[model samples]
Target: MATTTESNPPAKDSKGLSSLNEFNLEKSILRRGLATAAEIDACKAHKAKLASKDESKGLLEIMVEARVLTKSQSMRLLKEAGEANRRVEIPGYQVIEKLGKGSMGVVYKARQTSVDRIVAVKILLDALAQNKEFIKRFDREAKIAAKLSHNNVVNAIDAGDVNGLHYFVMEYVEGGTIKDVLDKNEVFEEKMAIRIVMAVAEALAHAHQRGLIHRDIKPENVILTKDGNVKLADLGLARLTADEKWAMSEAGMAIGTPYYISPEQVRGQVDVDIRADIYSLGATLYHMVTGQVPYGGETAQEVMRKHVDKNTPFVPPDHLNTKLSSGLGVVVETMMAKNRENRYRNPDDLILDLKCLLQGESPMIAGQKPDDLATLAEGDVEDTSRGISEAQLIEVAGYVNGKQSVIVALAAILALSVITNVVVLATR
Candidate 1:
């Protein structure tokens, strides 16, 4: 274990001689104890070999071999990097269970003593404490997310650094991500898909109004709650345009997941704006409704290139699963248009279109001939009990008509008999 010291001794010779000798000796020891040039070179060679053998070994392994960070440290740094700012505590929040693990850190489900409520506690690795770039990015995530408050967006409660480890606390979303739902159920119906997408779009609009852009928008980042609500999480790569200090200074380094990246991001455009997010949202919606990505590539680089250079694939409802409506196809295609200008300009526009779609309106072209709702085939709708099918409604209507006819016939017969009886009594 490393020893902690309160302060360093003053550099002074008792005999009034120069203190340079002692300073030099200390510096020499520190330099020797640190990673040597030969060791760094060896680590690099090992990394190259590993990369050649297994392409799946993530970049974190290279950082670890260079003595820049340990495996645990790298994991922690990535986890805390994504969380919003909050106080870090040790032994403060009791760990109830581990929520999940990501590339950077492990998330724990804990109970905060102060509030007596459950929160997700993310712990960063101690090795990353010396990495300034990671620290800046980590802190910025919390600061940026804290500025925007929306029901659809996950809220950050607190952040802090404890000992050498950094951590952040966030509201615990009880349900899993949309990805989980999709894995279990391959595709979503038009109405259910529209509802989920609209919630996410509203959340994005709220953040956009605050000059915040969620750079990473994908199914994995969207959570579906048990209460039938959608929550947007993971704002680690989100950018605040209005804040000059928060602007990214790094160039050429891609910051988003390859599959969901926008064309602007793949092209390394520093001025990427809200439209990029619109494209990602479109891709997400496409995947949810059609059960496939807009484009498929064998490698990450190839995937990113497709976003920049290739046209989005045909996504008619019959293309993937025949159950989807053609109108849903049109909405996805419009949102995922290759040209940014052709896509929805803002989240508000997308949300409005989604709402219109849910209300049986033509979202793509206003005043255009509406599709025949009666001809639309029913797919497996999310069994939320609230979804009423046309077949069920028809059955109910038939039952009601039969009952009404029987009641009318019985009343007529009773009235005729009563009239006959009254005439007989008058004649008598």
Candidate 2:
């Protein structure tokens, strides 16, 4: 998935052109850092020699034959080269420079000529243009983005297909993403991290309230403006909560970055809700505050297994960065609970807890309450202890960080009741 972050523009490679084919191929390969000059020259010489022998092999074909470029890689660059020559002829918008590319298409910084405003345009790749499913999903992304109007969300300006080219227009953000900030500053200040997370919490609340779930919420999708405003971008994986057809279409497919993906998402559960977004947000916060991912693995599957496997423990963020407050740690842990039931069910509650933390108070919903503030316990304790009183159960429940604790407490109480009834019946 891609966001509209502008990268250093691709430089003109192979400056002094030999022929159109060689120049275009060299530009494509060199621009992408795919091949060396020796590799390109070898293909060029071979193509020249083949031409002498009446053997008609294109430069790309010669490269494939010589193991210089994979067949798929050469084919893709050839397509990109074809696109490079033809200016994206979207009427009324003047293309400026390439911003970035993703699985979907190439994003370009463009000038909306009529409004004279700078915007980002994503033109779908010609390769996937013929697939109705991709077009529908691409249009769905535009619609989903348009449905949200929060200040912390990248707004959709327009979306349409002209001459079979599907294009999406969005508000151009000048600043970098949270990932960029992490790259520059290893970790964020505690208060700054809270504020940044709070902004995204509010944005997710807006989407969730409208029954939309942003399935992907990694640091790359959390955009930071030059003025320090946080905007959540990349709604390509977002889907309506009520859309079962869409759910089935994506069923059993893990649809998020392995690092920040939720456990249910990693498990490929078809019924993921806003809680999935909350989990990803928690992982993103963990990265921001700790300068490390929640799980480390040589491969993505291993990392995802750590997310899905009950045996793998979820370490609190404070465990990694002892500088973090316990309140923040508890919040991250609860939000990232492998069981969705333990995560914050309502986005508004998450925002509220973050607000409390921002004010130097513990997160009420996800963090342990202060001793003085601990009132009646929420539910009964499950353990059949020898001397613990009912008051102790309630007290323990009040201090529990998440719903799982309360449920465990309740189950212990139920087990004790069943055992007592069985003993009484045996005595009778």
Candidate 3:
């Protein structure tokens, strides 16, 4: 996930051109520094010979081998060229000002000349356009965002490749993200915080019904309008159930912000579903209610470790802000339970509880205890089965009930044994 922060224009740097292909190598080399005639001729000859033999060797690799261009110099020029190329005018939009810039893309506040509509255009880094896998993921995000139509979600207007630069156009949300608001106002009013998160919860419910999971949910991704309305932004990390077969994230690597990541996400589990989003949303709400995030550490890895470690119990929001009710704290805790089984089973259930709280009624999930959390093994019945047979479900329920009864019976037997031993020793 990209970090959201306001900054001045990016300098002409090589950070954006880390994935340069062979095609741009020559120009990048020339721009870096003047090469002697012998050096240039030698590099060209080497490149030609390599291409003739294999026809697949990258120019940078061949040039570096020929000692014509240093790796650092080649990298520097690629960055400069990429920065200049991306600054060109877009096909339909007239660039106004940069909204924000990240390593992968720059979000520009632009106007569509044909329709004269203001839109936020996010242009991906030129280097990414050369990467086939990155293109597929970018297209996936665009397609998913375009299909979603909700008042509380940012709408994707258009997306396409322009001169090998992938860009997505979205409706311009005039206000800043929830993070921006929190920066100025440390904490929001209790009612206002609930309202904002409630809107986000409803939006998430809609996405969940369509088999979409917004893997990255944080205050940075939640935009707030001038009129106090919320719009969930940044579907770049979203995934579709149908596209799970083609998931791009590598094994052992999680795709989310550390501060708000769910326990399953921290463990890099592949079966992340809507419950992960619930955990993140709960963390976001926790931040909104208090001035601090739920977890904090010196590094991202440490924060993620905290998420996976049940011993590092989350401090309730009420503890941070004395005015917050214990009931509301329980609601957030249930949503952020370490185990998905302890969380709201579905987004609708979460929405119902949030709505209940809005109406001054006790939250439906207020009684969830830490002991209620249950962990499922990778190939367990609950993990693999989408739909359970009626008889199977009854059997499972009976097993669970019987297990509880067995636990109670065992405890009673142990206690009796202790008492019997005490009596025998006293008589002796």
Candidate 4:
């Protein structure tokens, strides 16, 4: 569709244009680092030279004539410029280039006018602009992101609407996402994966401390820089732990990617929290070490079904990747346990084990915790009779010794004490 030639000219503006200007193409190209100003000047001169012969030759046409740009490149630039002009108009930021487009919106690499710095701006898609739910979610995401401040988190800058078109700006990260590298067929080293995971864990810790839970923690949402800085991205699916009213409203809708979503999210549980994020980060770690998702299925529902199924066979990372250490594998398994109670209680604990694995030592926390035995049962597959296997029974027995059960026991003992005191007074 972008391969059209000059014969099919775009709607014309009156001639006598400033030499280097082509609507927004020149500015867009320069802002995106696609071409230099000198290169544009040369193309302008070429356009001027050929103007007498063909008055209709445009800036893009001249660039193609001089071999400065391929037809497809010129067309794509024109298309993006047209799109921006048609709908989006953020007041203080200049949209540079369309970075990407997804179901929710189009993200652009933009320059903040006042600060004169690069930022990424996400504009709600025109198709969804009138949807109240989408607009509310978009606004909420911006507000929530602005509350977080951490080195490993993408910083939110500004958010507003101009004539009904909404845009949210954030720090521009200049590297590929984990999913990008995985798509390129490049595999991450075990230690590198551990370091990256640890960085995200730190980010999650910051968010969790503030009572925010990032429901979607997939590889695509984690950006990795060449300098080894890992930024946890996209708080679109994040929710406040105390937002009971909002939680009830979204009670039954699955809210995250199937490949990395937690079991609680898959079930659309209202009480989903930081532990759900822990499960997703674990799934991401599993993909990082093995170069594959934890489970594969033809459909999203099939994949999500496996996440909530206790009977699903747990395949440890070392089983998939021979180079994986047992320590790192144990950490992944614990993080992705079918039961959130069996997973790491929080990112602080997860980070500790991740650090230990980064060293030559085994996980001093997750692998050695009191709930480690219950985590073991979470890693087992049930028998044909669909009942808990003998091994699972032993692991469940170990669970009575867990902290939650002990707290329950204490409450029960207090209740019994109160009852006994009342009986003695009545007897007297």
**What is the lDDT for 89 in model 4?**
59
Q: Per-residue lDDT tens digits of candidate 3, residues 130-220?
A: 8888788788788999989999999999999876778889989988888987877778877788888889988998998888989999998
Model 2 TM-score? 0.70
How big is the positional error of residue 183 in model 2, measured in Å on the Cα after superposition?
2.9
Query: Candidate 2, 86: how far from true, in Å?
Result: 2.9
List per-prediction Cα lDDT, in the order shown: 0.68, 0.82, 0.76, 0.83
> What tens digits encode model 4's per-residue C-alpha lDDT throughout 38-144?
99999877766776667657787777777778889878876765665453457777766567777788898888889889999998988788999899999999999
**TM-score ranking of the models:** 4, 2, 3, 1
Error of 4 at 59 (Å): 11
Looking at candidate 1, the ten consecutive residues that score lowest on lDDT are: 366-375
lDDT of candidate 1 over 86-140, digit per residue (tens): 2234556765544555655557677887778888877654455578877777777
lDDT of model number 4: 0.83
Q: Which should have the higher TM-score, number 1 or number 4?
A: 4
Each prediction's TM-score versus the true structure: 0.63, 0.70, 0.67, 0.74
Instruction: Give the per-residue lDDT of model 2 (tens digit) for 139-218.
Output: 98999999999899999999998988899999999888889878776798889998999999999989988999998999
Clashing residue pairs in candidate 4 (N, C-alpha, C atoms within 3 angstroms): none
